[model samples]
Target chain A: MELLANLALGLETAVTPTNLLFCFAGVFLGTFVGVIPGVGPLAAISMLFPITFYLDPTAALIMLAGIYYGTTYGGSTASILLNIPGATSSAVTCLDGHPMAKQGRAGVALFMTTIASFVGGSFGIIILSLFSPLIAEYALTFGPAEYFALMVLGLIAASTISNASPSKGLAMVVFGMLFATVGTDSQSGVGRFTFGSMSLLEGFGISAMAMGLFGVGEILSSVGATRIAKIDSSSAKLLNMLPSKDDWRRSWLPGLRGSSIGSFIGALPGTGPSIAVFMAYAFEKRVSKTPERFGHGAIEGVVAPETANNAADQTAFIPTLTLGIPGSATMALMLGALMIHGIQPGPTLIVEQPSLFWGLVMSFWIGNLLLLILNLPLIGLWVRLLLIPYHYLYPAILVFLCIGAYSVRANPADVLIILGFGFVGYAMRLADLPAAPLLLGFVLGPLVETQFRRAMVLARGDFTDVVTRPIAGTVLALAAAILVWTLVSAIMRYRRGMKALTRNPTG
Target chain B: MLDRDYRDIVAGLGLTAIGAAAALYALFNYNLGTFTRMGPGMMPVSLGIILAVFGLLIAFPALSRSGDLPPLKIRPMIVMSISIFSFALMIESVGLVPAVFFTTVIATFSETRVPLVSALVLGAGMTLLTWSLFILGLGLPISSFDWPF
Candidate 1:
């Protein structure tokens, strides 16, 4: 009864003329950013964060949330139409989506992706509406020790999931932690890594780093790549694009399973659509009757990862909204935005700002509907977005990135740091180290350190509290298990490869 | 293909050296307190040591490897590095609108043979739209370089 009443209040708030307009605007902007290849939702939201400072909190949050999920839906368009992925989450879509396009099924791929996105997005919203309050309430019981443990779990999980060598991932995490220590020490008044620079006092800006790494790095990588190709659409028509009966049958199960997997993974801190999409792809490959068809225009391949990615994109909001711990880079930026608005997210947010919480949740469903409507009839329009030449598109993205970084603190040094990180990011990419773990490390590094210090203070310098407390202990054990499992598996694989090499030395 | 083990060795050694340098610098400037009560230098110093260890591990494999990996493409690296630096340098003086427009135009010309007029128009139009939406509509206070000083 209370849930229903709260939802009614939410509906009342979200349906207001002002809030509705912001929702529409956010979704539209999201699709535009997602359509463009270089910029992702993380950059878009970070760029938009400062602009939302003047708006009502409800409207600001609704619009930001819309952009986050809307980008997931829009990202697939480029993957299917062109061979390029608009965002990292859409990388898997390129495998089968491009093949489908080559087979003259571009319209069908777009249509099915839309339907799958809607289904997955709605399911994620439902999970959010049902479980967020419970999670928030549970999170309130956490002390500094529990928080530290949770951060450990988040860091380890992120490192293990990174699509690179674990050593590199660990190294990046440590490097990020070091970067987090660059500003003034919160406990003491002394500046550690600032080296007497005033700009370093505030530490590195998240917006600057994100813009430099993802935005500038993207343009740099595109310098010698093939020019963005135009698709021949003389035979393409919407009427003939709807999914067949067999397509529907294959899609429904994967959509449901993907949503379930995504929501579960997303609920955990630090995991996001990238991991969810990868997991969904691996799962689909394992279960499909003809698994070899996966990378060659299988409709199920398109539906599974697309569904999971969107679902994870939406549900990843749970931890960010409830616990003040961002589950992804985009969520981290949203957390930054919320802090700018003077809204501290946690258990108290539910009681203090029920309208904001419910209003944002309700707007998600409305935004998903908006995305479906916008993407389907306007599929051709989004496909046309790919026609823009890279030369023109990348430079504009670079401008937004610079402006966005500068806006964070109105500092030029922030822009420099972004560029520095962009070079580092490019190097990391060249070395085959995943950039996602670096982001995870940078965002979560300070939180873990702060919590660890606080726990020690509270326990009178006793480190055992992290493992002595029941909740904290359980989480620590889980993290340990995951780390151990990963190490064991990696070693096994290494040994197997070595053995294969030795056996084939002569043969 | 770059030998994974060899690459790891080089990375590990480099990290170790960097970590050692950082530790020495911090120790000279900041005090390292007891293990029970960590000072400012404690975490970084400890992290540096760990990195050094990993670096040594990486170096062990490189020491044993005889073959060399192919050299990385320097063109993309140089191009990208310059582009990022240019973006940071020009953002404020040129203003977001003109700065981005000019950067886009230059970057486009670096690779493909885009018509100059088309690139200019696209860059200008995008800059205008972003300026209006982010600055004017959303009240971001983005300044224009076109104003008479």
Candidate 2:
């Protein structure tokens, strides 16, 4: 009865013409950007960030939420149509989606993906509405110790999953933490690393850093490499948009499994859809009847990843909303957006602003439905969109990125910071360092510091009490275990490589 | 050429310098209070030390092994950087129109350029669109031409 009442409130807010219009605009722009190979939802969100400042917080969040899920479906479009995955989470789709496209099943892949994505997203939203309230209620019992430990676990997990090696990712995370400390320390009211620059007083602007790192950094990385893929637009006729009976039989079960995997992983801090899609693909491959048919135009391969990624994108909001701990960098961006509107996103948010929470939830359902309608009949339109060349596309991006960065405070310094980080991000990519961990670390740094300090005060300076507390101790233990495990694996790999070198000295 | 790469070594050294600078600044300028009443400097100081250690670990292995170094495309990097930095320079003093026009011109060199006539048209189109979006639609506090400077 309470669920129904809450949902009714949500619909009441969501069905307003303002929310509906922004939601459509968000998803439409998300798909357009997502279909472009180098641009992503991250870039699109930041580009649109300044515009959201002019909106009511509820509409702002509803639109951003729409963009997030819209990008997921759009990424699949690029993967299937052009064999060019827009984001890393969509990379696995290209393995089978491209092959399926080659087999002239582009329309069918689009059909299955839209249906599966809707199911996966709705599955996540249902779980989110059902579980987030309970999680928030339970999290109300947490103290500074528990929060601190959870942040540690989250940071480590985020860092480790970022790159092939743990140490490099850790280095980047630490660098981000250092950068986060650049402004005046909130606790002491003393600037640590501002170096007497007036513009450095507020540290880095979140939108500015995001745009520079993902938006401009991506452009820098992709400029040198030319993409060569062709899509036969003639193949996407209306008749081919129906899945065969065999395809349907194979898709439903995998979609269910993928949604479950995505929800579980997405609920966990620091892990996101990239890991979920990979795990889903690996699990489906392992459990398949014939593993040999896995990568070569398998319908299951396309279904599992698309379903998992969409589901994961939705469930990732669970941690961010309930605990104020973001599950991914994108969630961290949303958290920053919320803070900008004076809506703190911890446990109290649900009780304090039930309308905001429920309204956002309702917007997701309405937005997902809009996406399904948009994606199906408009498959041909998205294919035509691929004809816009990079030359025309990138200049528009540069102009918008500049405006987005400048409009943060209408300060020119923000643009300078964007330029600086754009270079930093490009350099990190060249050095094979994972960039996501840095964003997560930057977001979590101040929060972790405050929690740690508070926990110390509570413990009366006895650090031993931190280890004695059961929940905090367990969370910290888990973080330590992951750290030790990665270190051990790295050492083992090093030794094996050495052994191989010694055995084949001449070679 | 061994299996391991020296790319990590360079990255680590750069990180170590940054960490050391941060730690040294904090150690000198801020009070490191006891754990009971931790000062603001405690977090950055600790993070700096951790960064140095991770940097060492990352850089150490690379010292013993050789790795292939791909030629960095210095051209695109410089071109994009200059274009962006130029806009940063002009957005406030000279205004949005000139900033957009010039930056678009420079950024175009990073890839295949359209014809000169087409490039100017594209630039004009971008200026008009930006004027509509940022100036008209969003009401950012900037002018079409702040040209007295």
Candidate 3:
């Protein structure tokens, strides 16, 4: 009852003419940016961060949230229409969505994705509104050791769950952490890896790294590969937009399961929608009565991961808003936006700024509704975006990348760093290393290091305190278990590969 | 004598050597007295060692493997390297708009194109849109707008 009352208050705040306008602008801009390859919600949100500084906090947050959710919905359009995933979370969508497009069911895929995203997003918002404060209060008890342990678990989960070898993923994680050490040490005020360069003082910016790795790396890869855009020539009728009765039956269970799984995983720090989407896809396959239907234009394949990705994207905000710790890069950018507005997002935020908090929440629901209404009618327009030539698209994307990089601190050096990281990102892709862990490591590295040092100082250099503290101890134990499990799995897979090779022995 | 795994082995060994040297240099320059209270070199030195170990791991595998070596795509690799280097060099001098426009045009050379005019138009239009949205609207300070309207 209180939730409903609070929500009504939130709606009153968000539906104001000014806030509503920003929400529409945000979703519109979000869909545009989200349709482009390489540029994801993180880059778009970061690019918009400076603009949000002057707006009312509620309106600014509403706009940013709109971009976040809108991008998730928009990512599916490219994956279905062009066989190109505009964002990493949409990668799984390509497997089935592209196949559906080829079969002239592109409209169905688009419609289903929009519906699933709306459902999942609505579910996630409900969960966030009900549970965010409780989760924050619980997280407030976590000490430095607990935080370190949680990060370690996150790294292990990311490495093992990624598409590449655990070794490569771990290597990337280490590389990212090393990169994080390049700037001045917060504790001692001394430089570690800068080698006396003044640019190293501030360390590598997250926006620069994200744009370089995901944005520029994508351009380099696209340049190297030949991709002919596939446009569905068949005219999709309005009647074909809705899923078939059988399709709905197949999709509902997966959608529900995905929402549950995504919300749980999204609440954790460091993991994001990509991980949730992958996990949902894998889970749907594991539990399906007919697993082989999944890579062959199955509607369930499209629905499950799309739902999970949006759900994870929304719920991931819970940690960022309530605890001041961002669960993903997009959320981190949102946190950065809040800080720029002189509003620190943490336990006191709700009490200090109830209007802002509730207003933002209210706007998410409003934003989701706006997205559905905006996307449904605009589906044809979005599909037409696929007709745009890649040559034209890539250059515009590059310009946006450069501008976005420059906007961060207004430094030319940041732009250079973006370009440099872009090359490194391309190299990493060529080596088949996952880029997500690197981003995670880069974002969380400083926080983890600071926490670790603080814990040690508090404990007077007693290392045992890392495990002796109860909550921290449990988290460390979980991290250790993950590490052990990963090692065991790697060794098993290596032995199995060796055995298979020896048995074939030059046949 | 070069083995089939020579390239991988060489790359791995070179990386390992570089990592070790970096670690040693960092350790030598680090103030251990201050490090007792938690210093800058602590994390870097640890990471350097870990990197060296991973490099050695790659080196060991490369040394042990026997196979027909896959040839590195030198052309694409070189093109990519030069593309990146050119972007760094050109971004400031030419400003964001022209730099991005020209760099992207060059990047497209990797693909076989039928008509040159189509590619140029595509690139120019993309640059215009980006300039309008990010620079003009967002005020990113990316262009001097050298071209006359």
Give i-RMS (Å) per prediction: 3.7, 2.1, 4.1
Write candidate 1's Cα lDDT for A251-317 as tens digits.
Answer: 8888888899888887777678888888998899899999999989999889888889878877888
Cα lDDT tens digits for candidate 3, A1-507 = 877877888888999998899899889878877776545666555554545544667787888888877777777887888877766789999999889888888888888898898988888888999997777678777777777776666666665554356655666666677778777888778877677899888888776787788777776766534567668645344566877899888999999998988888887765678878899999999999999988989998899998898788778888778867665556756666677567888777776777788899989988999999899888877767767666556655665666567665766677678778877777665555567667766766787788888788777788886779987787678767866876688667656656655676542
Off by over 4 Å in 1: A38-56, A86-88, A228-230, A234-236, A282-293, A492-507, B1-7, B34-37, B55-97, B146-149
Quote the lDDT for B119 in model 3.
59
By summed lDDT, the worst window of 10 consecutive residues in model 1 chain A runs over A498-507
Alpha-carbon DockQ of candidate 1 = 0.41
For candidate 2, report its TM-score. Answer: 0.96
Q: In CAPRI terms, where does candidate 1 land? A: acceptable
Question: What is each predicted model's overall lDDT from 0 to 1?
Answer: 0.74, 0.84, 0.73
Tens digits of per-residue lDDT, candidate 2, A1-507, equal: 999999999889998998889899888877877777666666666666666776789898888877877777888888888888777788899988888888899999988989989988998899899998999999999999999999889888888874678998888878887889889888888887888887787888788888888888878877757666577887777788798999999999999999999888888877888899999999999999978888888999989988888888889988899999986777888888888777788898888889889998889888899999888988888888887777777877887888788877888878878888888888888888877778878889999988999999999999889978999999999999999998998788777766766787643
In model 3 chain A, which range of ten residues has the least summed lDDT? Answer: A45-54
Task: Please provide TM-scores, in order, for all candidate models, with all chains considered together.
Answer: 0.90, 0.96, 0.87
lDDT score, residue A432, model 1? 52
lDDT of 1 at B1: 37
lDDT of 3 at A149: 71
After superposition, candidate 2 runs with Cα above 4 Å error:
B1-4, B145-149
